[model samples]
Target: MPVSSPQIINMGCRLNLAEGESIRALLAGRDTIVINSCAVTNEAVKQTRQAIRRARREKPDAELVVTGCAAQIDPASFAAMPEVNRVIGNAEKLKSEAWEAYDAVLVQDIMAVRETAPHLAASFSTHARAFVEVQNGCDHRCTFCAIPYGRGNSRSVPAGAVIDRVAALAANHGEVVLTGVDLTSYGPDLPGSPSLGQLVERILHHVPQLRRLRLSSLDGVEIDDRLFALLTQEPRLQPHVHLSLQAGDDMVLKRMKRRHGRAESVALVERLRAARPEIAIGADLIAGFPTEDEAMFANTRALIDDCDIVHAHIFPYSPRAGTPAARMPQVEPAIVKARAARLREAAAARRSRWLQSLIGSAQQVLVERPGDRGHAGNFAEVRVPPSETGEIVTVTIKAVQEGKLIA
Candidate 1:
């Protein structure tokens, strides 16, 4: 099948979608479909292959290109597939020359990459809010993570570039989310090593028109003093914070090579809530980690209530190849699935309670689509009467249905 333009299938974090926007611009008018893959979990890898197969079935004659974490980690695997014509590395995919050539597999040593240049996208296709990648790669080697191999050491985009991108997108998008592999670790590689808080302060100070600013998932240990100050004082910065809290048990956290302990995680949440009572906390929790006993799992369950985490992403541990966690004693698949379900259940209950609390409160929602369902600054999903897409409006919450606030 002949295609008019490159079709990009982005998988994984907001960062990938942000990168996809840049890739879309570079491959404009080209007869190809690029699969920007994620290799965070075994299931993610499976989905990447499934997507490639589906793409091939739909567009049999179109040149198929694969890139991103999954392709970067295992380029040969993607290249070996009959459906994929070429496999580009994560670094290569960003370079204009790599996409321009668009002929053979172009995987490179991602670990050697020392700096990350900002890829500015005019707007986002998936989200009403624009995602500007402020940082790339991870310096900390978590036991279960394979992302460091895919995205090199921690490197930050210059604050000036990020501000410019946010300023550009602000014209079209009301909200801009600062996305990265490790957002809190941003700016350590740059000159004078400015902190993430400093970057955010610069953006808000420079771009007054940008209505809202949000940060993607952050590490509990890395919340700088300036960022904490902003969280309490700045209304423009969204009140929703998603933490990378892998496990709630101290032992499990240690095994995962996390910087913060279970107590530290709880304390951080407490501090954030104290600073801004309206702030909605979200977290990523891993269930059934290797060597995690029932007691350890219980600690994780208790953490949900202790931290008041309304929005939680519970992942049943899927051991990845070459990761330290994979080599450890594995948890039974059934047990893993069960624990994950319980965590989800707890999270649902918390979310329901949170929605119920907002029933009578007035909220400013940025309309994501036509039907009036948009997220508030606190990241609560509010459904209102028919409204224009991308318009921010204040509505009084009236009722709750299926965990969504009705306005």
Candidate 2:
């Protein structure tokens, strides 16, 4: 439904951001668009709610829609709000009869394991970077995660469809990042058991102009020799990988039912480094789970320090209501906070070390937004001499300042 005024909002992750942009295109005829959502932590939930209130104040009678994971998981709370006209879960609001009532609509559909082909064409991103969701849903039921329950099973759109979308995105001067609930799980139900490597090869071959093709999080256990070899051959593939390492302690990993533990995870990172020395590796770490004590937390810190990780996402364990970890003995908030502080310090140190390594090295940077001073890239911030916002520039790192590289 096109309205003289319309706003769409999203919460959480790059994958969710991509879907929100798609929804914006679907409702493009609307004169105004506002996205009010994100759900990384409880704090993000507060930020999203405030964004919704602000949007209501700005566009009093504008059509409004609230979707994505946060809205899908908790529609009733959103529906009770005075500003929300309708709340649909997943993408179900697109099919709602009540959509006619307001100039805008909100949909909350049950997260499905699979996705039907999108009816709308791919969005031409105005930003230098665009994210393409190659897969959705998770088959692994991690004890601490509510993701499998929120987003059904693993499913993938056809490889051809993904390439077509990338082509369109590339035409608009954007680098494409393949994202999903678990990107390594892509192509499970698709024809011929197409591998993630095959998908990367196809996209690189077809869309040669694509500035960069980055992969989202992948499972360390699933990293095979074939995939590693493909990375060496495909120069377009980004040298960065964000492996999901929820816990480094074996007992904690077993409780979480993660497929891999510290030893194997460490090996995978080593393999990647051996194959590509310049690779930037990152991982996700959880602190203070039900099974995590000071010893377990220490083990995690040691593993991260030894793993040669370029960066880390440190999160305190939040017990989602229905997860197995929630039913287990919960950690004290005080303990979680302390562990998180330690991990944050470690992560910052590693990030600074990685930035230092980039000094005097030339890197291809896809310029994002123009900052007050200059532009930001994957590695560091640069003050381009008379920098233009959208252009991709090659620059040599002149120095390492604080935690970022200066060019």
Candidate 3:
């Protein structure tokens, strides 16, 4: 295949975006169409297929390549697709040599790989802010999750390498978001087994020019004391924290094999708020889990008010094959969809109330692009006058319209 400009269609978490950037950098000026797929849910898999078809239709001459969790889990399924010419695994996708010698499907068992290398991207093509991958994979086996099978074991990039990458990005990018499969599970694989907080401290110490540092989704139970202290002391660290609180009910959490309970999650939120009064909190909540009754669902609904979760990513339970939850007593599809909608409604109300509170407050908005739409330190969407794409500017909240802060 003649080397031409590569087109990458990335779907899924911040970590995927970060990996896609690296893949883009590796396949620069190549005539390849890479569809980075996600298998987080059945819908995600369907979306990946849709994206592949769309990519093929748009660029008929381009060579289609598939990779990421979806492809990693089911390589043969993607390979059988007529639109796809090649399928690669999660680990293989990061290697330059894999792309260099890309002729056939090359996917290996992810579990066999023990170490994670820091795959640094020259720049990000999708967003203004740069996401640096600090860790990869998961060690925990949540009953509902099939991610560990695709992503393999938890592994961390050495803290020094991470600091270097952050420093490099700090030179050009105002904000650097640290991303990973299991972000809070970082550093357990390293030699000293330094904590995520230690890595944050190193980045702060080394990269003084970096304006803001943000974190991707974190497991509440994995948060160390050092990180909690930083939450209180560090102003450069973004005030918003998105926790991976899958369920709010204690029994449901136990069924999910999650580490944190309802009380623990609530206490963590309260502690974070006490440390930083203006801090905004977000969470990932599942609407209908296996064996969840009306009372259990009500606990999840009440958690929105209890935790003050203004921003939420609510997912209705979808049983993935090979997971323990797939064999459990299932919630009806209609009930799941309805519960998801209700959860979304509740989240919107909480978000509206939070935005209303911020109506008269001054905010520092990081301009994502020229249209004056950007995100505040607390991850609230803000609209202001036109500014430089990557510049951070101060704006006063004038009103809330259409669920966004207007300045």
Best by TM-score: 3
Quality of model 3 by C-alpha lDDT: 0.91
Please state every model's RMSD to the true fold in angstroms.
Answer: 1.5, 3.1, 1.5
* TM-score ranking from best candidate downward: 3, 1, 2
Predicted structure 2: lDDT:
0.71
Write candidate 2's Cα lDDT for 297-407 as tens digits.
Answer: 888988777787666888888888677888998789999989989988888888787787778888766666652223233434565444555566777878876555667
lDDT score, residue 58, model 2?
A: 83
Model 3: lDDT of residue 256? 98
Worst 10 residues of 2 by lDDT: 371-380
The CA root-mean-square deviation of candidate 2, after full C-alpha superposition on the true structure, stands at 3.1
> Which model, 2 or 3, shows the larger lDDT?
3
Whole-model lDDT per candidate: 0.91, 0.71, 0.91
Model 1 is weakest, by summed lDDT over 10 consecutive residues, at 117-126
Summarize candidate 1's per-residue lDDT along 1-407 as a digit string, tens digits: 65588899999888899999999988888888999999999999999999999999999999899999999999888999999899999998888999778567898899999878545776686678898999999999999999999998999999989988889898888799999999999987889999999999999999999999999999978997999999878999999999999899999999999989989989899999998999999999999999999999999998999999998989899999999999999999999999999999998998898889998898999999765799999999999888877789899999998788899
Q: Model 3, which residues run further than 4 Å from truth? A: 1-3
User: Which candidate, 1 or 2, would have the higher TM-score against the true structure?
Assistant: 1
How many residue-pair clashes does candidate 3 contain?
2
